[model samples]
Target chain A: MKPAPFQYLAPRSIEETVELLREHGEDAKVLAGGQSLVPMLNFRLARPAVLIDVNSVTGLDGIEVEDGTLSVGATTRQRTLERRLSAGGSGAQDGGWALLGEAAGHIGHLHIRTRGTVGGSLAHADPAAELPAAVSALGATLVARSRDGEREIAPHEFFQGFFTTALRPDELLTRVRVPSWPEGTRSCLLEVSRRRGDFAQVAVAAVVAMADGRVVRAGVALAGVGASTVEAPDVAAGLVGEVPRPQLIAELADDLCARLDPPSDTHGSAGYRRALAGHLLQRALLDATSPTGAAAAA
Target chain B: MDVQQESVVDPAAAGPAAGVQEVTIRVTVNGAVHERPVPVRTSLVDFLREDLGLTGSHVGCEHGVCGACTVLLDAEPVRGCLLFAVQADGHEVTTVEALATGDELHPLQQAFWEHHGLQCGFCTPGILLTAYDLLRERHGVSEAEIREALSGNLCRCTGYQGIVRSIQAADESWER
Candidate 1:
C-alpha cells in the first residue's frame, strides 16, 4: 500500500533536526524510529506537510543513571532498557518493582522492541501502553525541546488526557528522568489482554512501600482506565499504614475501581475493564508484595 | 524562529524535495553496491524487490506489523516497510539473497529445510534475516530472548514452534 504524498527531509544532525523543525513550524513532525508514526501514515491517520527524519541523528539514544535519577534518551530502544534492568541497573536504590523492566522486555516481541523506542512510546501516548504507566508511576520527568527552548514537565503534568500530551507543536521530547526507586517500594505491572503482544484491555502498575514489615507508602496507577493513566491515590491511601494483608489489598483495589473511567470496546466492556482493573490491581499488589519482590523493594 | 516547522506526514517528510528531483540512491545489497536514480517516495522494500530484483523481502502487511519485509540494515535487522530507500543510502543491506554465497545455502536456510520451518514460505525471508542477525550478533541469546525477537515475524502454518526451534538450533551451530 502506498502512503499519502508528503515531503521528506533527513537531517544529518540533531542541530539540523531542530533547525528543520524550526523551519517547518506546525506542519512538521519529527521522525525517530518510525515504528509508530510510519504505520499511522500508512493508515492515513496522520498527514503532516513535512517530516523531519531524525533516524540518523547521532547521540540521541542512550541511558544514564546519576545521583538518584535515571535519565533515558527518548530514542532509547525498549529492549535496551530491558537489558539494563536485567543486569540490576535500577537507578540509585533499585527499590521499585523490577517487573516493569520485565514488561518492557515483553513488549511486542523482539523486532518491535528493537525499533519501538521508549520516547516514541510515551509520545504516542497510548493509554493502554506500558512505558507511560511505568514512567508515570515512577513520577518521571519529561524533557521537550524546540527551537525556542527546552521545558521539563512532570509525567502527571505532561500527559493531559488520552492521546494528548502537553507537548507543543514544535516541541520534541528529548529524555525522561525517573527518580530513584523509593526505598521499601514494592511495585508490580499487570495486564489482561486478549493476546500477549496485543494491547491490554485493562492494566495496572502499583508500588507498595513497607516500613518495619508494615505498608507505609503505596502508589498505584491504572492504564486503559481512561484517557491517561490514573494513579489510584484514594485507593492506595487505604493500603498505606496497614499491615501486610491480602484482604486489605483486595479492599483497596475495589475502592480504586470506583475511580476509573474504563471505555467499552471490542476487547471488553467498560464493566469488564473495571473488574479487571480491580482484580489485576490486587494481583499486581500481591506479586509486588510477595517474597520474590520483597527483596527488590527492600 | 526564522524558519518553517513542517510536521510529520507532510509533503516534505512524505514527498520529494521542492525540486522533485530523482536522486541516485546507492545501496550495498548482499555485498554489492547498486546505484540508481530512485524517486524520493520509494520504499526500501520496493527498491529491493522491484528495482534491484531481490524479492526475498516480501511485503505482507505493507505496515511494520508483519515481518515479511525484514532486512538487515548495516547488520541490524529492521522493518523495511517502515524505512525509505533514501534512508538506506550508503548503508549495507543484507536480504535473503545474501544468505547463499555462491551455491551453498546458509546454515539457517538449511536448518529451516531440515526442521520444516516454512509451510507457506511467505515469512521465510524475514525469519531468516532476523535469525541471521540474532545468531550473528548474539551468539549466547537464550531461547526466551530468541522467541521474543522472532515475535515480530509471523508464520501461519508452522505454528512458530518449528521456526523458533530452527532459529535456536541455527544460533547454537553458527555461534556468530
Candidate 2:
C-alpha cells in the first residue's frame, strides 16, 4: 500500500507552481488535499515522477463573492465551503449557493472533507462525486492556469469522462466561478448512496426559477448515471415556461432515464442506477420547487 | 512560518528521478516538536508510527476508506494515510496518544471504557480522535449527529451502539 518513490516539491506561489508544472509536464502531479491523489498513489494506480505539493501555495484557498457571482478558490477545503453555506447569516443560502453546501455535506466524512479540496474533487472528475454535478448544475466556470496564462473552461468542457478532464498536464485548476441564479431560484441536490458519506449510487442536482407559478429557467444535472456529470439540458428545457407539477416531473424523469446509459458495477446494476437517477431527479425537482427548498437524502 | 526554505528542493532541479528522495520536515505531534527526514512517499501515519513511535493510530485500508488512520492535523480530523509525511511540515498533529493526561483517561476514553465501546479495540483509537474533533467543534451533539459524524469510521465490533453511547456520554462531560 506504499506509494512509489517520487521527489516532492512545495511551491510557495501560483506562478512557481505553474512553472514547476510546465517544467515537469506529464511527469508531475499537483498534490492538493491528497484526499484522492494519495489514495491513488498508495494503490500504485498513479506513479508520478514528481509530486508538487500545492498546500504551501498561497492565494488558492478562499471563497469570495463579487457582484453576485461566487468565486471559490480552487484549493478551498470542502469542509470550509460546507461551513460557510451552513452557517446562518453568511448570505450563502440567500445567494443561491446553498445547494453547494448540501452537496458538500454528502462528500466523504468530515475527516475526508477537512483535507479534500474543491478543485481536487472537480479535477478528479469522479463520475459519482457530488461537487462536479453540483457545479455543473450551477453552470460554473473553471479557471485553469499554466506558465503561459489562465484560461476558463465551462463545466461541460471541464468534465470529459470518468477520471478524465479537459485539463492539460501543465494546467492547474485555480478557481471555480458560479454565476448567481436568477432571483426566486430554488435548488436542491439529492443522492442515494449505499451508506452516508459513500459515493452516490445516483445523485441529482436541480435548480429552478419560477415566475407566476410557471418555470422560467431550470438547470438539472445528474452524477453516477453517466461517464461524466451529465447535464440534462433537454430535460431542463422541457420545464421552461411550464408549471412544475408532479406529473410533469415524473415525465421528465422518465425522459432522463431513457437517455442515460449508466455503467454497472458491483455497487449497482445499470438498470438500478437508471431507475435511481430518475427517482432522485424527481425528488430533487420537487424539493427545489418546495417552499422551504430543503433537500432530503434518499 | 519559520519553515526551512533552504531544505525545499528547487523546483527546476526536481526531475523524473526514480530514486528515493527524502525531505526534511518539522512537525509537531502531540505537542512535541520533532524534525526528521522522511521519504517523499511515506504517509503521515507511517511517519507517526515508525519515526515518532506513536502507534495508536492504526492503519487499515490504507486507501482512506477505513478511518483507522484518523489524526488531527492543525486541530482538524484527517486521514493520516491520505497525507504525505512531508506535507506535515510546519503543521500540528494530534494523535490518540495526546488525548489523556498521565494516569487519567480523557473523557471520551473514560466513556468508552465505561460503555464497553470496544471488543477487539482495533478501531477505537481512530474513533476516539474522530469523536474528539467532533466534540471539540460543538457541544451537546445529539445521537443522530454523532452517528452521522462517525459514518466514516468503520467499527467491526460492538456494532457501534456502545460507541455512540460513549460519545454521547463524553459530550455531556466534555470540557472546553
Candidate 3:
C-alpha cells in the first residue's frame, strides 16, 4: 500500500526547518533518516500533510567528542557511529562508545542501520528500540530546537510512552549529548530478540563503575518491558559499593523478576518478559563488571 | 526564500482532487537520468517499476522487513519500498538491472546460477544486490560473515545453503 499523499519540502538549514515547522505546525512531519517515518507512512499509520526532509539541512550530520561529551547531530546515522566505534583505537572493548556500538549492532540490519538516525530513533521512542535504552542508561540529553529557541531535555523526561516523546510538532530534535563514562567504568549491552535483526523482546544496558574491583556506581536501563525504556535507578543504587558476583547478580535478577510487571504482546507473555528482562540485566551486569583488555589497560 | 523544489507529476493527474499531491523528481536510475512527475506517495520501488519501467527490484514486504525491494541509493543498500521517489530527488539509484553488463552475467549472478542459489527466484535480485554491496565493501569475507550479512535478505527457497555457497564462491572468484 502506498502512503497517503503529502507535500514534500527539503529545507537547507535549521532556521529554515524551524520556520517550515512553525508554518506547518502539527500538519508537518520532520523527515530525518526516514527509517522510522517512512515505514509509518507506508503502513498509513502516519499521514501528515507535509514532510519536511531535513537531509539538506547543513551541520546536522556530525559526531563530535568535546570535553568528554559526545555530541551527535540529529541526522547522524547508526552506521556512521558504529563504524566510528569499532574502528581502531576505539574497539569494542572501549567503554563509552563501545556500549553504544554494541547496542547499535543489535538494531535492525546493516541496511536499516545505514539510514536510521540517532535522533529519529529516539524521537520515535519505540519501547523495544535499543538506542533509547542505551541512551537512557548513559544518561544522555536530547536537544530540541524550534523557532523560539533550543532546550535540553533529560532522557527520562524526553521519552513519554510507546512511540511517543516530549517533542512538540513544531520542534525538531537537533542534537544528542552523551557524557563520558566515569574513569573506571565498564559497560555492557544484552538483548534477546526472536531473530538476529529483530526488535528486542527484552534487553538491558548496564554501566558499572568499579573502584578496586568493587562497584562504586552503576546504571541499569531496560527496554521491551514498559511503555518506554525504563531506568532502574533503585537497582543501580542497591549495587553501589558492593562486589559484583554471579550470586549477587542472580539474586537481584530473581528479586526483580518477582516484583516487576512487564507488558504482554504477541512477542512474549508479561511474566516471560519480566523474567527475561531480569536475566538480560544479570548478563549485562556480568559483562559490565568483567575486565576487558581496555579496562585492564585503563 | 526559494527553497530548492521539483515536482515532475502534475497534481491534477495524480489525484489532486482527493487531497493527493505530486512531485517531480530527477533520479538517475541505472545510469539514466529521468525527470519524472510521480505521486508524492510513490515509493522508490514503485517509481522504478511503474514510472521508469525497471521491474528488476521486486517489492515483498513494503514495511522494510523483507529485503526483496533492496536497492543501492548513492552506493549504499537501502529498502526501496521504505523510501519515497521524492526522497530520491537529486540522487543516484542502482537496481538489480545494473548488476550485469548486457549478455555477460555478473560474477555474483554466475555464482548463483552455478551453485543453484535460488528456487522461486523471487528473492534473488535483492540477495544479489545486497551481496554485491557487501563484496564491494569488504574483502575476503568468511562464510559466517557472509551469512551474517545475508541475514536481512530472507530466502524461503533453497534453504539458504546454496545462497551462502553462491556468495562464498563469488567472493573467491571476484576477489582474485
Candidate 4:
C-alpha cells in the first residue's frame, strides 16, 4: 500500500514546528519516529493534507534527569532510552527508570525500537503499548506544546481512548517527565504476547516500595484490558500496609480480574484478557517485591 | 518549504504537477550520494527500489510488521517501508547491495549460505542487513540475543533455525 499525496513540511526548530502545527491544525499530522504514523498513512487510515516532519527539529531529542525527575524529550528514540538504562548510565540506574527500559524492550524488536520514539508511542496511545502502561504506573507527566503555550497532563488525563489522546490538533508532545521512585522501591513490567515482539495480550506494570518487610506504597497499571492504560489504584491500595506475599498477591490479582472490563478480539477474549491481567499482576507484584526482581536485574 | 534550499528536483521539470507534492532529498545509499526528486508520499523502500534501483530491500507487508524492507538508516536497522523518502534526507542508508566487495561476500552472507539460511531468498537481503547491524554493534552475541534481534524480520521458509545458526556462526568470527 502507498500513502496518499500529502504536503511535507520539515521544520527545524520547535518554534517553527509549533507555528506550522497551528497553521495546519487538523489538516496536518506530526511525523515523529514514523513507526506508527507512517503505517497508518500507508494504509490510508490517516489522510492529512500536510505532514509536519519534526525529525529535523533540534533540542527535542534529549533525555536528562534533574531534581529527582527524569525528563525525556519527545523524539528520543526507544532504543536510545533502552541502551541508556541497560547500560545503567545517565542516571538511568534509578529504579523507576529501569522499569521503563524493561518495558521499552518489549516494544517490538530491535529494528522497530531503533526508529520508534518514546513520545510517538505515548502520543499514539495504543492500548497494548508498553510505554503508556509504564508511564501511567509511574505517574509520569506528559508535556504538550502549542502555539499558545505548554501544559502538563497526567497519564490518566493524557490517554483518552484507543489511538486517541487529550492532545489538541495543534499541540506537540514535547517531553515526558517521570518522577523518581523513593529509595528501596522496586518495579517490574511483564506481559504476555503471542510472539516475542507482538503486542501484548495482557500486560502489567507494577511498582512497590517496601520498608520493614511491609508494603509502603504500590502502583499497578494494566494494558490491553481497557480503553486506555488502566490504573488499578484499588489493587495498589490493597497492597499498602500489608506484607507482600504469594497469598496476598493472588488475592489482589483476583480482585483486579473482577474489576476489569477488557475488549474481546480475535486474538483474545475479554475473559482471557481479564484472567491474563490477573495472572500478570500477581507475577509482577512478586517480581517487584523481591529484591532480585526482573526490573531490578534489568 | 524554503524555496532557497537546494532543489535537486525541479518542479518545472514535473511539467505542471496537478496537486502532487514533491520534495528534493539528498541521501547517501551504500556510500554513494544520490540527490533525487521524490513525491512526499513515496516510502523509503519505493525510493530505494524504484528511484535508486536498489531492489535488494524487498517490500513485504508494506506496514511495519514484515521487516522484508529492512535497511540501515544512519547505521541503525529500521523498516524502510515505515519511512518516507523525504525522511531519509540528510541520512545515510546502507542496503544489501553494499554487503559484498567485488565477488567476496560479507561474512554474514557467507555464513548464511553455509547455514542454508534461505530457501526462497526473498527475505535474505533484510535478514543479512539486520544480522550485519546486530553483529557490528554487539560482540559475543548469544543465540537468544540474535533471535530476539531478528524477531522483526520474518522468514517463513527457513523456520528461523538456519537464520539463527547463520547469525551465530557469523558472530563467532565477527570482528568489530
- Candidate ranking (TM-score, best to worst): 2, 4, 3, 1
Ranking by lDDT: 2, 4, 3, 1
Model 4 regions lying over 4 Å from their true place: A87-90, A294-298, B1-18
True contacts kept of 2: 0.70
Give one digit per residue, the lDDT tens place, for model 2 in B77-176.
Answer: 9999999888898999999999999999998999999998888999999999989988997899889999988898999888999999999999888787
TM-score of each: 0.88, 0.95, 0.93, 0.94
Report how far residue A201 has shifted in candidate 4, in Å: 0.5
Off by over 4 Å in 3: A87-94, A293-298, B5-20
Mind giving the per-residue lDDT tens digits that candidate 4 earns over A62-118? Answer: 789889899999999999888886426465667767878878888998889999999
lDDT tens digits, residue span A117-181, model 3 = 88888988999999898888888899999999999999899999988899998899999998877
Q: Per-residue error at B79 for model 1, in Å?
A: 1.3
Which sections of candidate 1 miss by over 4 Å? Answer: A12-15, A87-93, A97-100, A294-298, B1-26, B137-146, B168-176
Instruction: Write one digit per residue (lDDT tens) for candidate 1, span A1-298.
Output: 3656567777665667777777786887777777778888878788776777766666678888768677888888887778776327553247663544755764665667767788888888888888788777767789988787888998788878888889877777888887765576767777778865777788777777777777777667777888886776676677767776888887878777886779899999999999999888878888777657553233
**Model 3 residue A232 distance off true place after TM-score fit, in angstroms:** 0.9
The residue ranges of model 2 lying beyond 4 angstroms of the native Cα positions read: A87-95, A293-298, B1-15
**Model 2 C-alpha lDDT per residue in residues A126-243, reported as the tens digit of each score:** 9999999989888889999998999999999999998999999999999999888877888888888998898999989888888788888888889999899999998889999998
